[model samples]
Every structure is written in C-alpha cells, then in structure tokens.
Target: MSELRTEQPHDDAGLRDWQHVHNVIIPTHVLSLAEVRERAGRNHLEVAYLDDVLVGCSTVRPPTGDTLTATVIARTLPAHRGQGFGTELYARGVARARDLGAETIETVVLSSNEDGLRFAKKRGFVEIERYLLPGDTIPWIDLRLS
Candidate 1:
C-alpha cells in the first residue's frame, strides 16, 4: 500500500480536494467550497493522498466547552476504503484533539455508512446517541471513545 500523505488545506486546490472527498463520502450533506472554507477556519481540515491519488479527508474539531470534547471525523472514498487511509487519518485526528486538550473524543457517523460505524466501534467508541438532523431522513450516530 502506498503511504498516506495528509496535508492541512490552505490553498484553493487543496481545499477543493478535501471538499471532493467529503462530498463524495457523505452525499447526504454535500459541502460547497465556501462551506468548506468556513469550516476550515473553525476546524482542522485535511486532505489525504496515496501516491498522488486522492483517497480521503479529515476534520478535527478542537475540544470546546466545559466538557473539553472534540469531534474527529475521517472520511474515505468508497474506492479507497480498507486500505488504511481512514485509519491513518483517524489516528492523526485523535492525536490533534488530544494535543488541543480534549478530555473526551467523539465521532459522528451517518447511519448509512456501516463501514464508518463499524470502524468507530472497533476503536472502542460507544454509541451515545442516534438521531436525525432536522429535515433529514437518515439518522446520525454519535459515539464517544471509551
């Protein structure tokens, strides 16, 4: 397997790459470039590649509030799943969250993505909630690391 390379998106092209992976993986909630830019300002957003091929993206929402909870989301293209891209991105997100003083780590997965749900569970994340966002049909599952 090619070594995964993750870059914090700073340029337009880099940002677009991140958006592509995110929109593709979560078709229910596609994000435009403007939205992605907005999110980048508030979160750590990154795009991942494997030997020059786009494979995934990640978001690390730094710990906030009295709970010091952070959200880490790793998204991999369907074609790239099971190749360790998600694993690498997830590890980096967790590390970054901890570095930012997270006392608890949480991840939210769209209920439709069985792979993501399974990945989070296997990593010791327990389901805390499963609910639908307003106007959305599919529910999202929120899991916290044990």
Candidate 2:
C-alpha cells in the first residue's frame, strides 16, 4: 500500500529528495532544487511518501476570487511509476485548492508531453487554452479543473 504525507515548503531534506526525483522524471523542465524550494515556500506545497520514501510533491497558490493556480511537480521513483502516485498527488492538490476556497484550478503543460496530458485528463482537467512559449513556437496547453 502507498501512503501520502504533506509538509511545508522549507522542509529542506524533503524538498531535496523531491527535487532529485523530479529532475529524473521530467524531461523538458530542468528545474533546480533552489527553484523548487522557492516555489514551495511561496504557496501551499504538499509532499507524498510511500513507506518513508519520497514519491511526489505539488505546489498550489490560491488566487483571489475563487481561483487557484497549481503546478504539480511529482515523480514516482522508476520502480513506482505505474502504481498511481501521480494521481494521488494531483487529487491531494485539487482537494487543497478547494479547501482554500478556490472553485477552479489551472495547470499548464507542454504540447509534447503526452503522459502529462493523459494524467490531467484522468484527473478531470480539460484544456481551456493554448499559447506559445516566449522564445519558441512550441505550443503549450492550459488545463482547468472546476
């Protein structure tokens, strides 16, 4: 069975472990540990653990007036990917947003990231808009859950 654990952003050791997992799992985004820590410190960040092992993390920033912006950076250790860690992380994030009085949550994903899109779809997220990256023509999709 898997277990989920939630903690504040400044928990250095937890954030470091999460950063390592994220670096290995996400191909396009090369986020540094410092960046992850900074974001976690800015908003409500949650981490998930499975038997003392770090598995996933998510960051949610509640906006004014019924909306929340969330970015979930989670990675299951290579051996745990198919066990639903990602889904659990997302569920927790959405629940946290709702608890914070947000009626809607928004997320963005790269166009080429099929796995992410699939995960979002499974979590009841629908594409609401598409925009190009600043320096490139690569399209990114914005998904919303309401």
Candidate 3:
C-alpha cells in the first residue's frame, strides 16, 4: 500500500530524487538542485512522499494578493507512474493554496503534454489562455482553478 505525506521542500531530502525523476520523465529543461532550492525558498513549495520515497513536488508563487500560481514539477518513479500519485500531489497543492488565502490558482503546461492537460482538466482547472514559447513552436496553455 502507498501513503502520501506532505512536507516543506527544503526539509525533504526526497525533493532531489523527485527532481531527478522529473528530468527523466519530462522533455522540458530540468532545474538544478541549487535552482530548486532557490525556487523553494522564494515560493511555497511542498513535496509528497509515498511511503518513504519522494514521488512528487509542487511550487506555488503568490503573484498577487489574491492569486497564487502553482507549478507542479513532479514524477513518479517508473514503477510507480499511472497509480494516482500526481492526483494526490495536485489535491494537496489545492488544499495548500486555499490555506494560503488564494482566491485562484493558476498553472501552465506545454500543449504537447496532453496527459498533463487532461489531468488538469479533470481536476477542475479551466484553460484560460495560450501563448507561444519564445523561439519554439510549442504553445503553452494556462489553466486556472477557482
């Protein structure tokens, strides 16, 4: 059986593992350990551990007094993918945003990432806008949860 636990990004050694997994799972540029530390320090970041292993991480920035934008950089180990870890992470993030007094939560995903888009939609996030990435053909879709 798997269990989910939440903790601050800086306090979780498993965040490094999550970053490594993210680098392997996604096609986007991966953040270095130092960069991840800096982002966590600047934002409200959290990690989800399944049992004793790190499975997901999310970062939330307060873009405005009433708006929090969240970015989830998560990856389940190969053996653990497709087993609801991402959903767990997202649910935790939503709860955190509410606790932080955010009236809305926003996130962006590459249009090519169909799975991510579907997941976000399933979580009640609506597509708000789309923008082209500089010098790249890929388009990014912005999603918001209220």
Candidate 2 has which clashing residue pairs, if any?
Answer: none
Q: Is candidate 1 or candidate 3 better by TM-score?
A: 1
Better of 1 and 2 by lDDT: 1
Q: How far off is residue 34 in model 1, in Å? A: 0.6
Candidate number with the higher TM-score (1 or 2): 1
Identify the runs in model 3 with alpha carbons over 4 angstroms from their true place: 63-79, 135-137
- Across 1-146, the per-residue lDDT of candidate 3 in tens digits comes to 65778777554465575466656655565668877677667677776677877666665664565344444433345566688887777766667766766677787777887777887888778889998766657788888864
Q: Where does model 1 exceed 4 Å of error?
A: none
Ranking by lDDT: 1, 2, 3
Which candidate should be chosen as best, given lDDT against the real structure?
Answer: 1
Model 2 residue 17 CA deviation (Å) reads: 1.9
| Model 2 spans with C-alpha error above 4 angstroms | 65-78, 135-138
Q: What is the per-residue lDDT of model 1 for residues 28-130, given as tens digits with 9 covering 90 to 100?
A: 8888999999999999998998899999999999999999999999999999898788999999999999999999999999999999999999999999999
Span of ten consecutive residues with least summed lDDT in model 2? 66-75
Task: Give all TM-scores, in the order shown.
Answer: 0.96, 0.76, 0.77
Which rank order by TM-score, best down to worst?
A: 1, 3, 2
